[model samples]
Target: MNLGVLKDRIFGTAPTVALIVCAVMATDYLVNIVLLNTPNAYTPVSTLLIALVVAAPLSYWLTSQRQRLERLRDDLSASLDAKQEAIEEADRRRGEAEEAERLYRLLSDNLTDHVALWSPKGERVYSSPSIQRITGYTLDEFMALPPQAMVSEADFARVQKLIRGLTPGGPPATADYECTRKDGTLIWLESAYSLLGDGSGILLVTSRDITERKQLELDIAKALELAETASAAKSDFLANMTHELRTPLTAIIGFAEVLRRSRGLSQTAARQVGHILDASNTLLSVVNDVLDFSRLEAGGLELDPAPFDPAAMASSCAALVEERAVAKGLVIKVKASKGLRPMNLDGPRLSQVLLNFLSNAVKFTAHGSITVALSQKVEGDAALLRGAVTDTGIGIAPEHLDNIFDRFSQADAAVSRRFGGTGLGLAISRRIVERMEGQIGVDSVEGRGSTFWFEVRGPLAELAAPEEEAAPLLDGEGGVRLLLVEDNAVNRELIKTMLEPFGVDVETANDGVAGVEAMRQGHFDLVLMDVQMPVMDGLTATREIRAMEGARGAATPIVAMTANVLPEQIANCLAAGMDDHLGKPINPTKLLETVARWSGRTHTA
Candidate 1:
């Protein structure tokens, strides 16, 4: 296909042809000059024949040999070109390989995780420079050291076992180990193990330091344990303090009630008695508020929901504060919506919230009326009950409204001193409403009025038939024998005074031990056991009495009359063979009702 080759082939025979012609001319001239010594005596045909015979063979031989040489030259030139290309290709491949090695070294030297390559025969063939940083050993030194010298005997054995079990194409395995650095500091290491491919049983291991993370985990665990211990201690302290506080309150309120009900007192004395009762009740309220707030703070406040009329509950709450409001010469109006069917809700807690609102209204208002409005509407399957206490009171400033429901916070120190309160009622109310999945807020204007409101949702429920109020002991019945187990002398006396008016025969025990003995010696209609006493507590005493009774004797109704009023404490009382729980400051009315209900009779003179 090359034109130069074609041109060479066409002109290649020209030299041979010219040489043949020259030879023919020379031979013709020699024959003419030698044979007849005349240039005219030569014969053209014969001479030409002779020259052609010799020159044709020579030309054919020379041309064939020259063509063969040309073919060899072309082949040699092609081979040189191919050889040059091979050399360039080899250089290119070598440069690429050098660059790849440089990149590999860059990554291996800079990485934080230590990398090591091990051959099939348990030899560390290569180690990254980071091995010095991770384990305090140079790469060469790390590779030189025996495996057993680098790790503990147990770890060496475990790693060897793992390596023996590895497959070339299987997933990598990971583990954590406690290791010691060259400086002898203990540290935790999380390591990943993998086997290389290509039928060579090589292993690759990568490891990083997790010492800080491990220490953090340990610190968190210790902190949690300490917090739990502190919480438990606080709960125990609050329980004891509550008992101490309520025991005295029971005596104070009980005697005050007895005195207030007595006949033939002078007007001044009656008024003083009333003041004492009011102060005692106020103190009791503060104590209760503190305890309630504490329970809420500790996430221990639980709602006990039951079916109760929302309207009736609102009216009852209003009535509770009615006396205080009327004494302040403030009119109270309850605009509870009619036909608000009973709903399943925590009636007592809800009432507590409403009472807080009304009490605040009465305390803050001077001459204006307090109105309690209750309304209900159906939303989906739930009935939303909204209760609001609106009053024309000395309204709170905008700044104070934001934090009015904060615990122990009031609208400035002046307001706290002007209106004596623990500042816990609104906070406790807020927590209660929130626990029931409700929202609470206030709308107020300075020196005009304030409205505190809450909205909660519950399902409509069938009204439980009204419970017959537990009647007091009636006259003309058999003597109802009872035992009062209390450690405090005043509380025992107060309880006896509360029950004896109903014609009941009351016996006394100083402690649970004495109470148990009394139960063993005689039969009683009921036992009022007080918790937290010397020798034994009421729970243990009740258990002892039950054990003495066994299966054949009738079960005496044992009611827990203690200052331990927490829900769990009540549950404990029930679990310990007590039939009921009566929390103190003892309500004289409820005390008589419990006795009458349990004893079922009163003594006749």
Candidate 2:
């Protein structure tokens, strides 16, 4: 708009424009003079001058405009290309971000576990859709809860402490808690918490339902408790049953032996008495077998070993079974090694095993002889003793051989019924043998016979002298004062009868209460106390008596004479201040032997 700036721009192109006009005019003059021959001043020059002034300036202006337009077009194309490139780069980044989001959703949505993100302020921010499956709560519902809603008030503080203690890339802490579901049902959840705040300011939590596992653990604990209680009950039942059975068995066996030994019956009456004694002895053996098996099963059975002659024990067992063998029209031969020395072994248990074999032999053998053999071999400072009972009988079937020693098992159920056995003898014997560090086994053919054998290691005793013969009740023992305390009337009368024959001045008391009163009133040299009585037990009365008369009680012997005859039962008697134990079904000889050993001094008779 300024005239001077306009003149500067217009005048800047004036000279170039004038020079083009002059050149064109001169060329036109020449062309008119030389070629066209129109050299007249007004003809060619006039036209040239006109063309120069108008067309030449116009061409220059148009040319300048065309160059400007071309440059503008090039710049416009470059700007469009740069814009397209930027838009394409933005689209690529957005696609990648969407793909990442899809992958995250795929992993989190399909899992059974609840995956969640919580703000550092303890607010639930993002929850995986699987939260619905695990907790019955949708993502929206979870997020809408209070910041600490994931944990109960009881657990909120603990969760907060756990969250605060988390460090980036450190081990995650795990804990289990009771959680409430959307339906208000209680469930257990095990959760792992991690600090995902390695730039992203949130805590990561992964959780799973664990209610069933907790239930399983609780169930297992109850099952174990029940099993232990059942085992204890079985042991108690076996112990009580043993005591009951032995009490009656003592009276039957003891009185039957008394009648048999007294020899006061007519010949026919004596035969019947013999039958009674035989039946009673068989019943006693059966009872003893059952008791042994029960104690072995309950782990209450133990061995008591002492110095004894092996040959003598086996011979004694053989002698007992010989009568049965003879009654059945069978011969029983006893073969014993003369070289047998005294050995520290459980003589009673050893005798039990041999008697079981002999009894079976006598029972099963119809016509052929039964052989009882005892032998010994020397080991290093020890003796390996072997005993065998062989019989020619309806032999066991090969299939039944292995199971014969199993409790309640026999060759057949028919065999058990016909033989009238509880099928416990061999089993009890096997356990007894194994406890002594011995082996018991059988070998047989179906029709010929069976042989049962056992071998045990024994410590040789220093002396091989035979058991001292039971001397007759000496003159000094004739007036030995004895107190018999028993609850059962039959037991008391039997004890009195057996002791009175031996010249013992025996007085009886019905129970421990009476016995204690009698002890206080009298000065008996020995008290034969019965255990398990009413009003007061023998153990309690013993303690009371010991306290009542200190030095005199110590000097006076108290012996336990009860049906409870296990070694532990005897040990209990001793522990209760009793001087000795005598298991009942009292044989007259043993009662007298115990009497002589305790009160009656052995004089040179």
Candidate 3:
């Protein structure tokens, strides 16, 4: 307790105590003086003693009262100190809570995500400034208008139903809806809403934009639909193509068989048979082109590159169409530039491109001459060999030229009906050339003629001379047997017949499992595997065969034969341990050549 408070308590107790003590002391002094004067009348010592007794009791009472006042002052001071500490603590806590609330308000206002507080009665209590970013409306405008104003017309009804279903006493419910921006663009938003506990009646809502996510979903749906449509169209085309292929193939195979079996047939009859075979081969080529075009559209085409003479390649392609040109009484010419550089090209694919151009020119030209030109042009430091097939034929319209490279599109419907083509040749050729990193284009005038051209770049180095010749037939002298695995009976028979002529002792397996069994049961030199089959695929069979080969301490080459010979598919086949690949329908010459190569025999034409 303070000294001043203690003094006030002591003084405030009473003036009566102070007066009593003073009277006692003064009486004692007076009594002492009287006793001295009346020394003879009585005992002066007794009077002095009585005065001392009175003063002692009064002094004790005054001292006790002052001590009691000091104790009361201490108690009052303690109570005041406790009250002041409590008030100071409460003020400090209030400041801290206010600071926290200020930070929360600032964050809520500045956050990118939309934040809003709505009353239980569905009134807009508060909205963040970010509402403008999401809905393109000012904060004040959003607060003034109904929340439904921002919802797209298509989604407003559903949003309303969802909002009405929310319960104040229940847990939060989530909803997604489309909202319209101020510029009339629609955006998707996902919102989470929950009720606040205060009786002041408020709910908290937070929303985020999902526009890009929604667009991606839509794009995925569209792509899926397109895939399904393409798949269905491909199935239909395959069915039609199978029928188209079998018709000509049957005639060719049957007539060829007849010519082989008959020794008495005349030269004229033999020549007719040869013509039929050529025509059948041409028709089969058309069917294959259609299938290839389909595969290319489905991203399923592959290329094989090897060294070849550009001049020789051009002459070979020209030879295939020369007869038709001659039949039409049209002069055909081939021109190769001097010192033409050899190139590393996909030989068969280049031939296919040349053949397509040559055939188109021959078919379209009635009397005018056709020319197949092979030349080398210097492009910077690189040497490029250019191949061009030009003819006086019915040319393309300017408007239809751009679309001619599209699958199943021709110059016109009339041209398709008159020419009887699948309209896939140019498309396939274009894709093949592009795959080779080459370019193809056409120059034409409607009534004049057309010139189709392509160019390839490679080293100008000279080719080494071929070594000594071997037998025409593939080597079976090693007693090596080949297992031909194919599902289609026609394809199997066709491959079997072609290989037999090359003296390759051939065995057949109808499916992948059979092929695997054949490899296990016999000492096979090679396995020709087809990809699409029942039970197990050729890729799986090839892997199994390779594993078995490792176990037996022997190695047998495996070759893949696939209708869908895509680059990815070929890579997959190679990855599965297949030695090489050949697309179907098999070319007899190529089949024999590959067989010779793997059978440890040099091939000679």
Candidate 4:
């Protein structure tokens, strides 16, 4: 391809051809001269004839040699041109490869992930500049030592073993190990490696520092364990306290019921009995809230969505708190939007939220009015039904506003002491509201009133025909049979007393063994089975009952009554054939509702 080579090829061929022509000419000349000398003919004609012969052949040969040399030079030129093109192509490819390497190096230096190549002898041959960023080590520092020196001493042998087992054509290998930094701090890394065979004494390695990712995983694991531990402790406490508290609660409610049913009771005594019942009910609410909040915080609460009359639900919630408001001489009002439709909502959870707001309002307000308003608001393409609970209660300070919905957070510590609460009501309410894809917030001014509101979307049917109200079913007469399987005697009595007013005929079992026995002998409409009972738990009993043959096989619905109210716990119960789940310190309304729904009867108080 060089011009010098082309010139050399051309000139070398010319000289060879010229030399051959000269040799042929000289030979002809010598032969003529020798012949003339031998014949004694030194005449000018002979000399002229010989000179002519030599000149014709020599000129012809020289001309022919020159043409051949030119042909050879042309062929050589074509070959040189091809070689030049090939050389240029090779140069272009080399430049491209160099550029690619430059870009690769740039990326490797800037990337956060660590990159390095290890030799088959377990030495680091090349490590990117990112080593400084990831491990506080310069490239020189890393290159000065074996790759294993950066690995934790505990993992060095394992890493060596892994390297030794690698084969050139084998599948890629991966490992997670801790590497020591320059400061002696260890960082977790996830490494993926493949062998690159170049007949060179080196292997390619790539690793990523996964310290944050690994820490997150560990945190999650620890959180789950902590949750489980707290759940167990709360469950045990609830079990023991439910038993202890229910004993007194049973006596109080039972005595009041007996007094109400008795003849010739004094007016003062009757009023006192009513007060006792009301106080007991309030205490029961507090207990239920504590248990419910614990379960909700522990991620045990769940929503059961169903179609219900939106107006009716709102009216009922307002009515439940209306008597309490009236007793305090406070004005209470409810406004239902026209043409309100049926909605799919978790009635119990929604009611809980409403009741908590009402209770808080009643506790804080000494005068003025409380209003619960329901109306439809149009946002974008969707219709949202907004429900607001506005109250003339002591307003929250601006500084405390943001934390009002946090668990155990109150406007002031005095609020907890004055208004007895677990400080979990708003937190639970917020969780329920958010879970339903709704929003909850408060509007308040200090020394004025506070308005707590929440909004949830309702079905279009209810939105269109708002006047319709679902009539409350008449209470069923005759005693309803209930089988209560609980280990604690006090809990058993409390449940029995609460149900007795609805004419519930109760049967009890101390544990799963007795519960199974009771089930075989009696035909009860419902079974409240407590989990974590001695001699077998509720889940096992439910399974056994489900496995029964004939009419007794999984017929009667079993509702789980346990302190373990986590989502997974509920799923486990259901999987074991439990029809429903209820947390401890169970709400009487919830129990009645579950009974009414499952027993195909209405409950009245």
Candidate 5:
């Protein structure tokens, strides 16, 4: 409303007004002055006024419409950009989902284990392509069959119970089931069932074929059974053969011992009897070696630990070989560490090992000394006892040392022929050491000498009380009343002759049946029962005698005198109520001691 604002507004539209005026003047000139020859009706002012009226309204409307159109175009472009960005994001998400689907199919289709998905109602929802390979059925065919159709009748109930116990989010259940294929062939399947953890009550199952593994297990079981049978048969054969062999050796050695004790005999006859005794003893040693090796091989040589003096055992073994050493003009000595205490060890078995070492040393050494050394050391609540037999003569070669402890192996064929051994001594010794959880080896140089050594660990044990000296085998008042039950006539006679000299009143029985009748009819201080007899075996007769003496009569002591000396056979005799066991090829001293100990009286007059 001010003068300056009015002037500015009026001048701003002056150019539009001037241009319109010029256009109006030009039109008037063309129409009236040139063609009609008429004079202009208005001046420049009037034309200018006419032009301003039209230009002002038109410029105002056009400026307002241009701003509104620009704002509309900007809004449309912004909306289009946002839509394009949203479209791009959607495409990327779609690609990711499609790739994941492809991977899922790739793994499920290629797996060897059959996979299945089931709904809560037990309806099949999906099956992997591996179903055909596992069950010989296409996915569609498998889905059509009931779940029980594929499972064998024997396993279907178990499978149902497992499925019924499944819970969402619980641990998977696994079991082996026998299933039938489409062709009705039976196969084993180790299957796992897991309930889906999504709370949808869906089930997932996986299974793998195990038919070949099952068959392998069955074959292994059969092989083990056959091995056990063969082992038992070998044991029986060995027992029988030992009985047959020792039955004769008993008569040979027993009669020889009797002859050697005869009051009047020439030097030639006495020397000949000595030879027979030596030969028989050597054969007995070989038989013992064989039986021991068999026991070791069968994993049945258990250790019986008791308190024993290692040094005394070593000295005893050396003494047993003293005559042989002296005959060869070889000096022998026992070197025992002073103050070596008693230890819990298998004394008999340890003695066997020591004897084997000393025997070998005396056999191989020609003119040098043999020393048996025993030492002991303490190690943290346990003691290590070591026994070494060192000899100076022919030694083992280096290569032979590696396999010298192997069963039935010798230094060489020449050594075996010259030394005359069955090559089982060192092997048996090695096994004995191993069973004691100990070590055994030899230090030797081909011809200079050999030293055999063994180290065993055991706890310190209390020494047992000394035993009383055995009484003489004759009583002044009355002789021992003993029944000799033996099937072999020569063996019976040999035993009778051996005992009669000491005043034993021997009652003879041909078999176990007669022995049992003899026990029922007469009172004998002891009975010497031989196994493998006719009519009845020793074990059966002993059992009958024990049963008959139930709460009514005195239980007579019966000793098993047979070559059936295997540990099991000894156990059977004890189980049948025998008081003691005396293996065949019996020693006179052992027989005398056994009778005296059980009779509780001397027989010497």
Candidate 6:
């Protein structure tokens, strides 16, 4: 407490009390001198009375005054103490505020990030020294310019809009924009903003340069574009190569089958023929796997769904691998559930999937039985069909089962060597089943056996009648004329030889130009048209033939023969007015069936 004022006031009272006591002493001395001059008798009585009256009253007055002075001093000291405490508290708070401001400047001035404060009216109030480092401008230089000097014209409107949208004490907002540095170079910036208010409200902006990040993003985009282009180029190269490859494989397999069935061969020679047939078939599977995987990866193949007998589908696919199973000393069986029904499905693709499972079973099993079963349950007239191919062969290991459906993956490298395969059959089957909206999986015990299964949920519908196979025609059936239009000499000769056994008249045209000319002069039951040729392509020829309606034009059936098996390619063929299509490496059975289907000529070609 501050006692200076109260102490001074108390000391002044002490002097006044001393003066009052002196006045009383002076009066007593004067009265004693007067008594000496007057009569001695009067002096004793008058002096005694004077002493009682003056001394008593004067003492009482002095005591009362002293007490009042003491009380006044106490009150003044309390008031002084309260005023002193207020002054000290104010000084401490000011020191703390100054220290806080010093610390804030210390951190922000050293930052790499740009920091700035603006008044509520959008005028710059404060800018950290870091702004000079980022923009190459001195503090005075920047402060001398207009508020919008550093802002980009392109982003000017957006910046104003964002600032105007901010609310006091609301969550911070972030923005990215372009700005000009002092050197006139444009740079990108991402900034976080908040409206700050500490009595005086202001806006705070913290920004970081993002020019490097933007450039990196651009570089990545360009690289991805180039990669996509390369991927597409690879797909095209593989597609063209596959077409060329299939052409020769068709001839190899076709001739081998004919040779294997030759008349009067010795047993040893027949066995040698069997080996050639088996090897050719194996090569064909490998080629098919590579091509199919390519198509699936490119998403060029699509499922064609239709109503097919579930039981018949399973039986037919099982039949494909039955001979191989029997040769391996394995028994094969087919089973259908009691209430199995025809379901809408991609018949050819489903059969291909089932064939993959059954063939794998046959190849792996040696002495045990292979069973193919189709179980079904009805759901409101639609049915859920589950097809399973179980083989009593060496089972897959537990660890390998997880990745079994991955492309080009096998149980192990040794298993791949022991079991000769391209390792793509299961992968292809999985893709086919998944694209059909079905699920496929496997269950097995090591050293026991394995069961591969698939389930398809679809509605029951009327199954189309099975297509009749191409049978050798008798002479009495009347000769049906066929115009075979192909560009390759080898293919022409092979087709002619393949069709010789059937009692049909066959004529050849070198290309579409010749085929069109030939068709005008001849009445043909069917025209086997190839897509690519010299002079004119098959699509143009077919359209041109349709244009001619005189002798053998619109009424004659035209079937496309080519190795372009993509659905889009087939669609293009049909869009060009061809009635049907057949992909190569042509199955002899399919070739004959296709011929019989359209031409009504039961010739095995």
Off by over 4 Å in 6: 1-83, 117-126, 132-188, 192-205, 219-223, 254-278, 294-308, 325-331, 341-350, 365-369, 376-386, 390-419, 430-487, 492-560, 567-581, 592-605
For candidate 6, the lDDT comes to 0.80
Candidate 6 structure quality by residue, lDDT tens digits, 466-560: 76655443343436678999898778877776666765567999899999999888778889998878899999999888778534323577899
In model 2, the runs with Cα more than 4 Å from the true position are: 1-214, 217-221, 299-309, 326-332, 336-348, 375-385, 434-439, 456-476, 547-556, 565-575, 600-605
Best by TM-score: 1
Our tally of clashes for model 4 stands at 8
The ten-residue window of minimal lDDT in model 4 covers 465-474
Model 1 Cα RMSD, 1 decimal: 4.7
TM-score each candidate: 0.84, 0.66, 0.56, 0.59, 0.81, 0.66
* lDDT score of residue 601 within candidate 5: 38
lDDT score, candidate 4: 0.76
Instruction: Answer with 1 or 6, whichever has the higher lDDT.
Output: 1
Q: TM-score: which is higher, 1 or 5? A: 1
Which segments of model 1 are wrong by more than 4 Å? Answer: 1-75, 118-125, 138-173, 197-201, 466-479, 543-555, 575-577, 596-605
Give the TM-score (vs. native) of candidate 3. 0.56
lDDT of each prediction vs. the true structure? 0.87, 0.81, 0.76, 0.76, 0.87, 0.80
lDDT of 1 by residue, 278-312 (tens): 99999999999999999999999888999898888
Worst 10 residues of 5 by lDDT: 596-605
Ranking by TM-score: 1, 5, 2, 6, 4, 3
Better of 1 and 3 by TM-score: 1
Model 1 scores worst on lDDT over the 10 consecutive residues at: 469-478
Show pairs that collide, candidate 3. none
After TM-score superposition, the amount by which residue 522's alpha carbon in candidate 1 deviates from its true location, in angstroms, is: 3.8
- Per-residue CA lDDT of model 3 for 1-605, tens digit only, reads 69986566555544545565556556555665565554344544564466456645665566667677787899889888988998998898999899988998888777878988887788988888888988888888878887678776667777656767766656777788888888898999988877665656677888889899988998999999998998978766675555445533643554465464467888888777777766677677676776677677777666666778888888888887887789899888899888876766677888988888998898888888999998888665457878899899998899988887777888899988987777788889899888878888999998788999997775555567997654344654534467899887777766766666456788999999999998888866667888878899999998887787775565787888666444556788899988889765455567777776676431121
